[model samples]
Target: MTPPVYTTGQVVVNSGSPISFTATDASGGNRTAVFTGLTLNAGPNTIRVRGSSNSSNTTPFFQNYITVARASSTSVVSGTTTTPPTQTTISSPYTNSAVLAGGFAEGSLSDLLAMAPFVPSTNQFGSWAYGNSAKTVTNDTITIGWHKGLGGSLTILKDGSGPNLINNNASITTTYQGQTRRENGRQSDWAGYGTPFGYNQNGGGDPYTAYSPILNAQQRDSGIGYNWVAGGSISQDTSRILHYETRTINWDGGLRQVTYFKTQPMQWELRGVVDSTYRHVFYWLKGREVKVMFIIQTFRTDGQQKFRGRLQEGPFMYITAPHYRYFVYTGTNPTGETGTTGLTQINLSSPCEGAGTAGCPNQNDTGNWTSTGNWIGALDESNNGVFIVTPYNSNFVGKQFQSRSGDENSNASAYITAGPHLQNIDLPGTNFLASASYYVGSLTSFRTWYNSAGIVKMPFSFSFTPGKTNGWWSENVSGKLNSDNRYEINIGGNGGQGRFYSPEGSWMANTIDTIYVRGRFYGASSMTMNLQWKRPGETEIQIAQFNNKTFTVQGDGVERTYAVRMNGVTNWSGMIAFVKLTNPYPYGSFTGNEKFIPTYIGKTNPN
Candidate 1:
């Protein structure tokens, strides 16, 4: 079946004009369709494709929006003129059943944290190559250590005492599709680490967020791996800033695109998705706060087949320490609950029993819990802590937070499970959206941003017209969206940039704001892009570089009324979006809400 095509046409002034669009089939092939000798319409001409699923095709499916706009400098000749179709305003409406409003405070890491210390990796930074030696000394304290190859690294201590006693090493195992993928550290380690067959961990010591303290390869020891090899390399530019690879392949041998950069001050970010499953892990830094965002779309199988999938397994923060106080929101916010999740701790009958009266841990249990308000925070008497917050929506419809030991209830190797999971047949695309933050400071500091809607929910709505700008001379360039909502923009007829601009509105431009571009690199080696803001008079400035990039802008009136553009220098394909935040920095650094639909019509953070 032909995939549904959603598009908006820019009516040209010339009527009976011919327009053409090229499409890529499921088999890595291209087909072009042209329309000639046609009468034009005056207003928005909407073309809606009946959405359906066809998994049998082995070829890539694409949807292209061919817009024909009149040139600004076109001459008005006296001869018979061709009038193109009028510009189309695309809109799809739905109801929330209940009045749901979301808001946030936008600002930079400096604006948020001021002078708070920020470090991306510590000895607790676990990894296989570095021999992540994370051990639980007691129920309230833990010790972690790693080797830099020159000699055994110091046994760095966490909230623990007594000569850093090493307990039985807790081995964390992760499985995907019923197969063991990894068996150490967090589930992300196993799921994201380089393949099991190779030892060269690419991107080792690479910081996921921006502005991390510059550390040599030995100290950093973080990297992204694919197919038993380092997908790419990490090099420090003349500015002393380290740049990580933009793309890699997963063990499944699927292309996983990545882009990251450290914003000024203390913020950093990593954004992109694996094209195959559309499973995305986005990282953003606001001050000392590092928020790891998760997103996944539901898939529909052939109906004849039965399949069960785990949307998110573990954002597990294994604090091998003892005497830690923990709490999970019970959905009841009293008249004066101080925190967003009501700040209620789960009283434990025993360290291994999890919540009080909540008996033995069951590994077989899916551990899915229903929560209208989602968040969990664990803190020791010293105030060192780990916290997590997840959206309360269909995307993250279920909640699961479990405190476990080495064995079922052994308490020998303690860890916390805090993520979403789904177990049902023919599951719809589950977004499983959530974020987690770690703080070495007081919970009060974490509470300020957390309580202030650090990760606020905003109603997303927009009519997007995807096109590219060629040095502001070409009327419009062409592109198409793949089945995954990724764009294959061909903007190099004469070497120009690919631009995706949001609809015009008074709220489009915000003074003293920041912009973020989340993109993927599909191997167009010479292609590059950066976020741009064009003033009313054609004056434009690059607000943020977009080569697997993200950035923030300061100062007022930089461009009060301007169009935001994601300009690419050559033919490129992947996911991308231009986001504007009212805060000098993206208050919470979570801006992956605008990928599926290319535009948004909601209030900005300040609004």
Candidate 2:
């Protein structure tokens, strides 16, 4: 039977032959079409009916049910039926004792303290306890305390009993061997000298408002307040446990506690809300390294808004036993230019601020300077230092560094200020999100990890528009997009090149080991291709001074993939802002119109 127009129907008999059936168009109600005189097999004769659309239109059709009956009996049999299996619950991986210890029950505080001193193979993940009725988490390197009496601000101590790293207001009197000696200690209360992350909505025109867990009377009057009023819970897994805290300031901003584990770093997820703007700060602490990330989100704006904010993680003071007197600036100038000597050093024993002497110039000397090199190291006489690496921040406008010399009376302090600096950023109708990351650790250890184990993925895509370069420019070469959407470059001259300059800033050079290039080489038997890059602070692009940079590719006119092994390149250290591919063959190697089509370029870590 022929199928109906715009509708389809099919039928098949078991073990014999297949047949088609026509379905009549029925309107408003249900209708049935029957077939007779069909032969049946012994046990179970399978019959199938299928319905489909005959036209390309996407209209749908439905079938309520299908029925089949025996010739002798009127009883119908509807397909096959089977019983479902039983459901069972799976047990949780976390132990009952671990859940209780990681929670906040009646006796959970004592249980949590007992599990605090966890020691792994590498380092000791110290302990957590109540100090002055406040919660404090301590490790071998530092102790961080928070809550009520501390003005709801985090107070950090070096090596548990050492001087305060967040502030230099510690003073105490001790008697030893009948001699009264006054010693420096943490402050009794962190009122004015509090390490709080806050923001100014009016572009620093008004005092900043801050959010804390529990604010004191003085803190409340001074723009510090708490939105959480109990109902915080803790949960645990095999590796780590999380403490969830709820808050409601100008908006609903939640807080989270650090996961206590030996292998993983302790991370704190804190949030703040002022007016319609919200900020989320994540702190990851392990040993001497402290990684901080700030996510700024603004909502309910008129059109565009201007604001100033900071992640005040430190006013880190230098210890007296080994005074940190040397300051090294490993960065570029305001215009992203590096001087003849990349490293700038100055002695911090002499106080300097806002562009001091020529030799001891600061960020103010460069007029709202931004560091493309992204790191600063402060060292003692023995080269034992603390380094702060900003890595790559696309949104950072103006960055400032301030340091004070140490004296017999006070310890030396160094801090950094990273913000947009009063720029009118375009806020798209009530929503905006921007972020920055900071890595702090010992200079020697940070360099080792930043190069090897701390690598991250860096992915970028290229465009094939004719005039729109999209941060990619051609020198001595003309490029166009072919019918297949591949960017084809015509070598106009001998030294033709195509380069991609990073539009945001410099990319972390150590993060990328292999650069995958997919394209074709045409019009010649073979050609020599060289991969080159510009390091951070470099104004001129140059060929990479390594043997691995030069590679020979066959011009078979077929598209192929190639991997540029930058790991073997010796000059691949430091941040990279520009990368290029050049045809380094002498003249007369091929026709000047020889085509080079590069379809894709990606940088990734294979390991």
Candidate 3:
């Protein structure tokens, strides 16, 4: 601080101080003038300000809140107050609730949303549709959605603010993309009128409407074919495969359609959608080495007709080619349900060894499980939680894993494991038919199985409790994914035990210390369970624990999905999965083959 009245604007030099200096002002170039006095060394001194405005460009003054800006950059450097960063937020155009509450508020929101509208999009490749012009999950991410059709015609499409849609029938998916265009390899050519002496390649006399001109009632050899390794888009769409096509035309029918026409069996393509979204069934691949295969069903959404001035060959069903990808559910209950934690379905009725002709996965159990055995489904998740299943195993303890062609894609499989509680005991153990009720998806959330009446032992239960938090038998076994790509739960037989209780007659509620059980499981893994379950299907592994406790659980069927990818490359073949265990630190668990690496892969181009 200085000792004199200093003014930063134009002022007469009547400065009073021990050492004074007069700063001139032009009011044009040097508007504000400064009068300094007693300017000794760099020491704190008292200074007074004269209220005045800097009349010249040379002088500048600031009052109240100050905002300092970078000298070189256009961004603000510092400000007197804090303001949150400006970000682009993604929100639905109109909340369903808001729309329901229509009023002035709705009118305002509608006006704001007027800038955006719902647009059709497609992803024959990915699972998520293009963002809705009126909605977006993120700049790149989208809420999974589907476009349904009237009656049975479904043309899968996505919608977003920017209005983007694509189909994967064209390129090399997400691979070989160095210099390739997304639209390069997606076109189809059906030889018809005007080509080759006005002859029709279609076996059907006249290109019919209800019938596709490309193929007659009977599937015959084709003159046109296309093949390529599936990737990002292919793998992502594993959960859903959509096929729909109309004309991309405007006011006057702007024409721009691709066509392929050659004599020798040649390959053609159409359009391309974005990459796919891959996920594991609550628990997907667990085998030492896993491989997935898929197929695409090409059919016409519109009438299959051929004429000089008509649309032909369109809306092909881009499916997962055989040998697609597999997701593996590997996490335990990230939630609180111990029973639901790492809960997976174990084939009780049949081991994953002899898949059905329609492609039902063989049971993966290590024991002698056959067509008669049942799936050891578990839902030991302490706090109740929901787990996903496939081809819902109706109480019919007979049918094995069925191909989800009706409700799920046939190219994928899932692996789930729950309840590390049940363990092995002696050959002679507690024998009872005590089963717990579990909730089923889409159906009854709870299903119960009672013991066969007329047993010798009285209804008196002895839930033998082991002092350990986690049980035994299952402890050292280290549940693992067998080569067959199924869970191997090892349990011994003998005088088994459980939390001895007398719930009905003489009871020991949460007693018997820690119950040693061989109960069933329908446990669910976390989202990290790298499984590739078809988006829409259900399966169950109803396991009967030795101690009369059968944990029968099921995953409800979700929407079906379709996708295909090449294993070893971007998910189709060369993939790395684990024999993951989900029991907390010690209690007891199986670590699955501790010394095995994924070595076996399905052979592509199989002879």
Best by TM-score: 2
TM-score of every model versus the real structure: 0.30, 0.34, 0.16
Model 1: ten consecutive residues of lowest lDDT: 264-273
The sequence of per-residue lDDT tens digits that candidate 1 reaches over residues 364-463 is 2223332223445555555545554543211111112234333221223333444332221122221222334433335666566555654443223322
Q: Per-residue lDDT of 358-394 in model 3, one digit per residue for the tens? A: 5555433222111101112322222211121111111
Comparing 1 and 2 by lDDT, which wins? 2
Higher-scoring candidate on TM-score, 2 or 3: 2
Error of 3 at 104 (Å): 30
Best candidate, lDDT-wise?
2
Off by over 4 Å in 2: 1-135, 145-160, 168-274, 300-374, 394-403, 406-412, 417-425, 428-441, 457-535, 538-575, 578-607
Worst 10 residues of 3 by lDDT: 275-284
Superposed model 3: Cα runs more than 4 Å off = 1-344, 347-607
Supply the global lDDT for candidate 3: 0.19
Which residue pairs clash within candidate 2? 170-185
lDDT of 2 by residue, 345-379 (tens): 53333334533457754432111222444444444
Worst lDDT 10-window in candidate 2: 229-238
